[model samples]
Target chain A: MQADQSALQCNACGGLCYFSPERSALECLSCGECYDLGQPDDYLARDEFAHRPDVAEPEDNITPAQRTHQCQNCGGEVLFTGPALSAHCPYCNGPVVLVSGDAGYRTMALIPFRVDAAFAKRLAQKWAASRVACPAGLADVVAQGDVAGLYAPFWTFDSDEVVQYWANFVKPGGKAIRISSTKGQMKIAFDDMLMPASPHVTPLIRDGILHDFDPRDLKPYRAGYLAGFAAERHHQTVAEGIAANSADKDLLIRNHIKYKIDRTGVHGIRYLTDTSGIHYRRILLPVWILHYSYGGHAYKIAVSGIDGRTFGERPFARRRLALYSAAISACVIALGMAIGAAAAF
Target chain B: MLAETSPLFAAAALFGLSTYFGLIPIHKLIQMHEARHELRQGSASRLRRAGGWVVVALWLLTVMWCAVFIGDWWASGDYQAASERAWQRIGILAKLAASAGGVR
Candidate 1:
């Protein structure tokens, strides 16, 4: 059952962005700016996208899990081959039939998976080991679903720009702390800033599971990729991506510019501008996403197919936690005795 | 002979204190397991989902803040400054810790 759903509502401009894989951009249906797929040059917080599929297309001739169907919901393309599986369409950030698509999914620049399920399990176990306040049935939480592995499409952007920024410098003006008016500038060149272009890209909780794509790793879109599994389309757009990236590039350039200015001991700056160029590539990275609900919380964990980098939360073990806490406490008390003995010295 | 072991003792004492106080949170988390089991039968609530993250984030960042500042206090030579800052830190910690008891 395909449903129409979208999560992006631009608070700045009462607008909605649809991910267009054709251009690998988040096109603001309202505005024409293409937000490239992929993360900006310096992103700190993990982001999550609700992948939607083409549920708005009223023609229901395409069978579920049998053909690559356009969603009636978000108008994104996807492979819907199984009844038991559903995924976010990357183009519209909605649920879609994820089977196989032939409508032109260009499989190029693939990064093969380096991390395997064993590592994913290990990393997940380790991560669960850390979330102590996590529920007691941690093992069950990790066991809740079949982890799906797929190569998600990403659009990478590179750019050069002339950026100007204003910053404050804390200077030692006669020992009394004085904040100085600081202006700075720099030339920033961005390379390989990745954005998710595939409709229904994986969320941020997945980490370290990227594969190094080689030419040999690419495979054309085949229905078999969805025969036993599900597939998703990208919902993020190049326009939204570029806007975010542009802001980021501007900030980074300003930071470097500020550093350059600060190093010169000049507390003030001038009409700072950046001269920069941009380049990009389309890539498909390997990821294994396990989505399940436990304790009423929807938990999604990503395991890197390359470096075993993991992200997300799950239930915690009560008995194990108790034992650990007691052990740690006992160890601390024992050490406290040593401190007492030393204080005598 | 004991002087050689003094540092170890001091480290252990602090570790124990930290561990013990932290047990309150650990216990609460474990107790939360029963609630999760009960929740299985009911529909998942987005409120609870959001609350879980909110609580976790708050506690995590605060603990990190405490650990960093407290570590700084121990590591720095200015014990007076550290001690004074410790009071300021504890004041902030107390406000946060107090807020922890009353989450939906």
Candidate 2:
């Protein structure tokens, strides 16, 4: 595949432009002009079904770091140099998407950043301040931290599932409990089950900040939306994503079966699941990451760019916790002594 | 009366209460640290696990010590005294209730 490149430049001043979340358009850095990208194409064309055979398999020998693209505006060649698929040209400062030899998979859709960087930092500070066990000045330290906005890769899967199960339950009779076996089949349709496609975002951070993203807001993939922001392609394959999605589906199926049975005495559950009509789309999700250090230990906090929700690690205040424990102990002892004196009287 | 008045009983109660209150926050802190470590390293550190177990062992020892003391007090016939003291408190509460009823 050849490299697909587009240079986002301001028409008025011919300066570099970036996507501004507040304006929902490309904003030039030099003259502060906003260019409206016209309506996005329909997102349906990006969905690739597993049963389809016409789609070409990803190339095995294309190295991401070695790939390079020529800037359309300056004719300057820019090396990817990293796992990132989108970056600004150093020479001309034009935003570019280097799509050549990107393992055959392309980002089909993206959820643009709704919460800006300043708001994201405030969210992180509020989250840190709310932790009761955190150090006294942790929020102040977090306020000074720099937050970087990046579009992370993710996969959304849709499938139809048929689950068959057998279970035993106890039926209470007039005088005794009788055990009986039951068997049944259930059909479930799962839509847009999201899975992270980048290893840079750890599972803990992913699970912590992930919330329901509105499918209606998914705009068709456009390079202008990624202007002035860092973006990465999927390092994980569709097959690997499917395997992870299967584990999640199995847990969901078990919960559904348990809910359907509605018996606490049920035991020895056995089940089989058959899945079909599997469809997937590679998409980009926005996130803001803030890295900071406290007491010589470094920590990072992630904020969802769509909703500004924050989650991360912070250091505990040992002296304050010891004081709280001492106070509680004293109160417990005093209450006990008072009760004893009243009883003696 | 003897159980309530015994210094050993008071000491045991204080020790149990202090240990319970003191170790709970530390245990929670260690657990949070372990979770962060696992998030970074993909597995829990042995030292953190040992710290958690040490907290558990301390709590268990406190519970066992309190249990043994109570068992000894019961075997020494202090329960009878304790029961009498409880009844005395109940009598006082009943008298107070009767006086309040009369005033009403």
Candidate 3:
């Protein structure tokens, strides 16, 4: 026996309602009724030590991308890979919300899909056609691929970093001249440093999915937003995601310091950095993802649900590459021969 | 003396120096452009591409300037003469500075 899974039902006609990206409202599929979600409250909780009772801490040793969900409609086993949110049961086609987390993992905040499925499909077609090495038949191949709209789990960190740095600037001429050493302190404040909280999602994929997202677009978590779309719950703790990006953040801070002080000749620089007043919030961002096979190889492309920004690995035409390489090599060899002849003379 | 006057050697040195100092930023710009391109942010990608080209053009111009300087030295055969003139000018400027400062 599985817990009852419920979806948004239209009050007018008893039809299923889905969150429409274009309308930014819920639309009934049967009666074509539109319901506005109105404004979502901006509630950002900032207690680093606070823990939600419903949220379970990740295991000390962690490895799991699969979750089992028993569909309430048909009692069929629904296998969810990664942090996927919503799917239809194969047995009954009933919409099933695969909650991978405990009650604590309920909706916190989300960036709803601004680009709808139709727009996503059109963008996919346009992107495939514009690809440089795309086969002539790639359009047909892409047309058959399934595109799923889902919200990926992310941890947005806000903090202020203060760094104490020391650097030795060499004299204009050389070390033989008087050397000047300087020490200074710098403070950098950043908000919404969003990192993918799902272990399977990388920064690259997240950027591909939500290019230049405005944090203002984040809405208070509502079950209605997850009505039509699949949502993934965060697997990695906020600390873990921050730890994953700590080295890069350090490098960024160092570069920023260098940019400020390394104007002339910098001999060496050393710095110590501390991030304070750290706060974080969990949110889900929309992405349109498709994995398709072409020429016996699989390819994946993701489009930002907020914007139409697309990113993916595109295949190159081997035949065209070989021809270009041959031509370039021939020209290079001829040029070398002509240069050698002139040198001999 | 020949190496000093040859534009090729000077150009090579300029290229090396420019490359050593500029390659990292150029690589970063190109990477930024590519990342923007991947995300289909056409305007942003174009901006990055233009910035990357500006850096390349600046490096090229620096190398060209060095080559032109070397060419002038070789063509005029006045490398030593130019150095002597520069030293004389510096001496005159220093004397003027001393006089203005009432330092005899």
Question: TM-score of the candidate numbered 1?
Answer: 0.46
How accurate is chain B of model 1, given as a TM-score from 0 to 1? Answer: 0.49
| Docking verdict class for candidate 3 | incorrect
Ranking of models by TM-score: 2, 3, 1
Question: What are the iRMS values of all candidates?
Answer: 14.0, 14.5, 15.2
Q: Give the C-alpha miss distance for residue A157 in model 3, angstroms.
A: 1.4
Q: What value does the lDDT take at residue B34 in candidate 1?
A: 34
- Candidate 1: C-alpha RMSD after superposition: 16.5
Tell me model 3's lDDT, rounded to 2 decimals.
0.58
lDDT against true structure, model 1: 0.46
Residue-level lDDT tens digits of model 1 in A68-146 = 5555665656554322244563333346554353443333344444555556666666665556556665656676544
Residue-level lDDT of model 2, residues A279-344, one tens digit each, is: 877788888878678898867788888878677777878776666665555554445444554444
lDDT of prediction 2: 0.62
Task: Score every model by TM-score.
Answer: 0.46, 0.64, 0.61
Residues A122-232, candidate 3, lDDT per residue (tens digit)?
Answer: 788777777653567776787787787767777777778888998865444432334578889999886666666754455566655565877777787665676666555
Q: DockQ of all candidates, in order?
A: 0.07, 0.07, 0.05
Model 1 ranges with Cα > 4 A deviation: A1-107, A112-123, A130-137, A173-175, A198-229, A234-240, A244-276, A314-345, B1-104
Candidate 2: stretches off by over 4 Å: A1-6, A40-104, A166-185, A261-270, A319-345, B1-104
Model 2, B10-99: lDDT tens digits are 556665566456757554655555455333221112222333444443443344333333343444445565455545545444443333
Report the number of backbone clashes for model 1: 91
